[model samples]
Target: MHAAVVHSFDELPRYDTIDVPVARTPDEVVVDVLAAGLHPRVRSGADGTHYTSEGTLPMVPGVDGVGRTPDGGLVYFVASDDAPGTMAARALVDRRRSITLPVDTDPVAVAAAMNPGMSSWVALRRRVGFQPGGSVLVLGATGNAGQLAVQIARHLGASRVIGAGRDAQHLELVDALGADEVVSLDGDDAGDRLGRAAGDVDVVVDYLWGRPTEQAMKAVLMARTDRSRPLAWVQVGSMAGPEIALPSFLLRAANLSVLGSGQGSVTTAGIVAELPALAALVASGVLTVDALAVPLADVEHAWTRPVRPGQRLVLVP
Candidate 1:
């Protein structure tokens, strides 16, 4: 079968003939992949520069995808640890890793929305005790995952959702997705701009890292009217760059709790178990997918697009 493969780090991705392995155990499931999600980590790992890089080559570019099996074909998986990505015509997944969805479930919706969708979901539901009326600040809130962060925050019952991004238009789009307020990070005085935009923020869900990460942290620090209540900061992505140098004073003074929300860092078993609940949310329209569809043959080129303003691409095989 044809599968999208990254031949080498820094080289463009390409398709190759891959022999799909047979299920060696009863627990294993074989699938015909229909769609795949392009994540930033997939590109970084493909380029051999990501933190989790093992210098692997000829890797399938997608980590999460929508797929179906031959029997019944009703259930599918969204993420895989050792399972094949959806960029392939045929893939083998651990049946346990797959999440059953409506056969009519929009794979693009699942693909475009799932990873980031799950990140924000996990952030609020697991990391922080996100209250019904609390405020949320999403830094880098327009990237594929970042946009999902804002949406999921709203679905999780955050009273006010604040989005921060590089472009004004992107922030506007995020606002449309239920962000009560949006902040633009690409500015001469981004700190001041963000400080001005923040409104009664109780929880800060941070996906921006490096300078923006520090800058957003400072913005949260400056916007705090109440100093005693803990402001939860959920760090999901580091697309701006991953070196975080947080001042100790923010945590000390505000009693702030900053969390690391790595999608894969958590056990795969936990994610698999949670997928059913998440799938139900998707089926009910609580979760929405904003995606651009790309042909699987063009996987290499699609991975190169810049992330911003609903740049999530779903590979249709």
Candidate 2:
């Protein structure tokens, strides 16, 4: 079998021939990889920067993908931590960890949208118990995942959705994607603009966690009309930076609760349980994303290519 092999943590993966993976458990079976997403999480694993990286060598790097089972059924599978990934001609998949997809499902679309789209879906549905009629603010609305977050928030019944990001060009498109308002985090008045637009939002899906998160957090907290109202800040990604200098008073003064939604925070079963519904939305065109599909042989080139805002890369085998 051939795969995108990560030989070194400092470099990009190369297209190389590797041994086919074998199922080790009764519930596990080998599936032919159809399409796999080149997501930021996969990049982190390939570069050995993710928290879960074990510094293993000559490894395949993919978290989830669409594949074909032995009986000619299509499925979307999540790779387990201890097994080889889905960026290959064939991958080991656990039956319990996968969901059967409709025969007519588009493999490329599912592979491209699932992982990124799942972040916000699982966060609101499982992590925070977000209710209908609530308002949401997406902190990094320009990125691929953030763009999906904007749409997902509205689809999940958000009364009003506000998108705030550093890119002016992407911010312009958020309104069309269902955001009630958009704020640009580009100039000197970015903090003020964010506060005024999103201060009273019921939920915040924050992807930028560095200086932007710090400034935005303070701005929203200070501008809230009712400080005692509960505000759920769900941290999904750290596109800007990892750490932030958080003021203690912000937590004490307002009803602000900061939590994370990701692999460790949410159970694998919980994440998988939400996938069928999210995948259905993606298939029905309710939750859509711009995808660039490339052949698996060109994994190296696609890895280096610059992806446009709100676009994702899918590697097809």
Candidate 3:
């Protein structure tokens, strides 16, 4: 069987041959890999940077993907951390962690949208007690997950959705995706603009969490019409930097709560519970994702390619 093998953390995964995966438990089944996404999480795992990395070598690098079972049923499966990932021609999938998809589902689209979309989906649905008619502000709104957050927030019944990011061109696309307002996270007045536009938002789905987040947090705190109003800041991804210099007064002065949403914060069962609905939404075309399908043989090239904003790369075996 052919698979993407990572012999070292320093080098890119190579297209190589590996033994076929065998299911070891009754709960697990080997499925034919239809499509797998080249998500940032997968990249981090491959490079041994993710918090969940086990420091294992000669590994495959995929978190979740769409596959076909032996009975010809289509499904979306999440790969176990210790097992070979879904980047191979065939991957071992735990049926308990998988969801059955419609026969007409597009594997590439589901593979492309699920992981990134889940970041915002899980954050909004599980991380906070979000209600309909509340306003939301996405900090890094031009990226793939951020763009989806803008739409997802609106679909989940947000009265107002504000998208703030640095890309001028992609920010326009974010607006088209259903953001009620767009603010540029650039220039000297970036914080001022974000504060003015999103100070009153009920929730914030933040993906950038470094200086940008620090500046935005203080700006929002200082500009809120009523500091007593509850504000939930759900930190999803740390795209800019890992740490922020949070001041004690910021937390003490307002009704602000900052919490992270990820593997540890949200349980595996919790994430899987929401997958069926999210997959249905993506499959039904209610939620849109721009995906570029690349052959598995070109994994090396695809891995090295610069990621374009708002576009996802899906590997087809």
Candidate 4:
């Protein structure tokens, strides 16, 4: 199988050939590569910066993909925890964890959308216990995860969904993605912008954890006018940076619940269990992914480019 192999952490990946392995377990399936999602995590893995250094040398880097099995079954997978990912001519995954795809599904869109889509899906549905006719506020709304969060909220019947980002251009695009309100993180008065846009959010999904995130956390905590409930804040990623300090008083006083959500601690079985319902959502068209497709040969460039908000880069592996 042809793949982009990373030999060293600080170096670029080189195209190479490797043997494709057969599935040893009945639950595992071998797939013919089609397309895979290129996220910052891929680049981080290639560069030895992704959370941990488990991805040793001679590894293929990609988190999720959409493709066909050796048996010609179409499938899509979110490889958030499965490393040596799907950036190759072939890859293997547990059949129980795979999402069988429609015969005519677009791999580029599905592959690119899978990871971020899953982030929002699991966070909103599982972590926050999202319900119909609720409200959601997405911090870093222009980023890939944030943008999908907006769509997912609306798809799940969020009465009001707000997109909070740093730019106008991305804000407009997020609005089109189904955000009832768009707030800028780069304006003169961002807090005011957020306050004016979404009056009082029921839930907040935070991706950035630096100053922007800190402010957002503070805003929601301090706002006495917002709708009060069992307020839940799900923190998925820290694009701005890690090491955020939270106010204990606000959290305790407001009965705010801040839960850290990610794929590392989540089991493959959990993902498998959710695949069916998620696939149904995908098939229904209520949820759509925003992606940028690139050739596998150009994986290097994709790694080098600054990731655009809500832009999932799919590689034709």
**Candidate 2, 96-152: lDDT as tens digits:** 889999999999999999999999999999989999999999999988889899999
Q: What TM-score does candidate 3 get on C-alpha atoms? A: 0.99
Q: Which 10-residue span in candidate 4 carries the lowest summed lDDT?
A: 76-85
Estimate candidate 1's RMSD in Å. Answer: 2.2
Where is model 1 more than 4 Å wrong at Cα? 305-308
- TM-score for each of the candidates: 0.91, 0.99, 0.99, 0.91
Which residue ranges in model 3 land beyond 4 Å of their true spot? none
Candidate 2 structure, TM-score to reference? 0.99
lDDT of 2: 0.92
Ranking by lDDT: 3, 2, 4, 1
Residue 173, candidate 4: C-alpha displacement in angstroms: 1.3
Clashing residue pairs, backbone N/CA/C < 3 A, model 1: 76-99, 77-98, 77-99
lDDT of 1 by residue, 1-317 (tens): 78888787868788777778578789887787788778776677678877766766667767777777787565646535554456787777777778778877777777667776777777777667677877888888877677777877787777778788888877777888888887777768888878777734777777767888787777767676776767777777777777888788877777677778675556767667667777777666775566788888887778776544566888888
TM-score of 4: 0.91
Better of 1 and 2 by lDDT: 2
- The stretch of ten residues in a row with the least summed lDDT in candidate 2 is 167-176
Evaluated at residue 129, the lDDT of candidate 4 is: 78
lDDT of 3 by residue, 182-229 (tens): 999899999899899999999999999999999999999989999999
- Candidate 2 RMSD to the correct structure: 0.7
Return the lDDT, model 2, position 197.
94
